[model samples]
Target: MTTLTTTRGDITTEHVDVVVNAANNAMRGGGGVDGAIHRAGGPDILRDCITRFPDGLATGDAGWTTAGRLPARWVVHTVGPNHGAGQRDRGLLESCYRRSLEVADELGARSVAFPLISAGVYAWPRRQAVTVAIDTIATTPTKVEEVRLVAYDAGVHQEIASSLTMATSVRILQGVRALHRRGYHGLRVNPGVAPSGLFWRVVLTDAADPGSSVRYTSADEAKFAGGVVDAMTTPHEVAEQILRALPRLRPANDAPAYAAWFAGLLAAVEPEHALPVSSADYFDDTDGWEIGWNSGLRYPAPPLDADSSQ
Candidate 1:
């Protein structure tokens, strides 16, 4: 599995196998990351670019050059779509990341560092740029073991972190659905957990009104059934909490069948949070029959009147 992370630092200084440059189509190096890379890597980079890409590259395409004086072995140059020039096709922007990873794969790079392409002089919206970078890199298949999304400033780093948190929250919700399909009852949503954004908490209750509560305020405070499981901030913690609570909620007989049912439910919902529904909204259906897990299975849902206990 690939690990994705973010940091605030100079992309040219990253000690990774490959560092990506947000270059213009000219590839001779312009402002922003392109200029910083060329200036730091010295003349050998330009010399190699001239010989390899004499006519320059098109937008959304990528090529590599010698790292020159930089710490990395190779500098993968990718031209981002100019959002200010009215070239707003998201596919072009996504192509930049996809093509760069393809180049990295060919070069046998195990770790790669990337800057927020097109968010600078190219005028791409910062939030959208970060989203595209994270989503594309996270989903794209590559042999690379680690991918770092580098931000030049603290503000940008925070923005990327927020995006990551949102992504993890979506994954946690998916995990909650997975546990529910396995016949693990007493699941509830903690809406008050997150004051803003899409960061909501999911709780596994032991009864209609939980006599006990495991408050997950900080990483150090995370506990499941009076024992440490995982940090509340991680998606793995969500899965672990549900698994640890399973035996107490249901019998151990045919556990594999329950696991298989959970897997099937997980696979049925593609693209993580594509269901267009939330745990809070699950009981709003007036028909009294709980919403079906998927199109094929329609198990009766638990009563919703007790949701206020959260």
Candidate 2:
């Protein structure tokens, strides 16, 4: 079975078998994810493109090149439809992902990382771009074991998580509800607090008094009621934040068990969001966390492990 996940990070650093680049038809390297990949993969990638694909490629088509200095072994280059250039064909956009996976299969790549094709400089609508990516990648069959959708922007991560129909999002929603049922109050995104870069906040208050609220930021800190916690940038991270707060808010010896359950839920879903925010301190201490329905999927969190130390 193929597992889908999302992350908030540089796609060039992905240690998968293959990393898909959202390239222009020229394939020489342009902007957005394409430029980042080309720059990180070093000159060898461009050299391969010059030698192997002297004539460039067409929109929606895919080709491969050496990874160069990147962590991955191969780079699958796919040209996305430029919606800003009057190219609005959904099929073309979908073909970019499909063709990339087909190319990955040809190379016997077990895992592939993808960026949101046509959503950047191509100007595809963010929500529709995410939907197309999820729909096409989920339906397409391949021997690849894992498909990672890497988003560099917090808003883009939230958009992808919201558009995903996988069971992980559903379970994460359920965990939010479970928090409410446990008598934790004021679980919301505080509009009073503005977002700083990729870091956002979620405020959880004591059920008895609304003013006695504890704020959780996208960083790790030690505090009583209000302090920095993990970044809830993706669905998995959101679920993890809730799970971590449960023990602090209420009496629950089974926090570890619940964490395990949520982790399992995350593993079962397609297009899962995986944001690693353990060492990121993008926001200042004065900028308290933001709280809202969408805030959960705007920041990143630590990875979920069987040891339950997430």
Which consecutive 10 residues in model 2 have the weakest lDDT in total?
222-231
Candidate 2 residue 159 C-alpha distance from true site, Å:
1.4
Q: What lDDT tens digits, residue by residue, belong to model 1 across residues 29-97?
A: 888899999999999999999999999999999999999999999999999999999999988999999
Task: Kindly report which residue stretches of model 2 are placed more than 4 angstroms away from their true locations once superposed.
Answer: 165-310
lDDT of 2 by residue, 1-310 (tens): 7878788899999999999999888879888888998899899999999998899999999999999999999999999998999999889988999999999999999999999999987899876788678868866878999998999999998777655533233334444545544533223222122344443334544333456544544332222122221112233344456645544455333334444443443333222333212122453323322222233333222223323543
TM-score of 1: 0.65
TM-score of each model, paired residue for residue: 0.65, 0.55
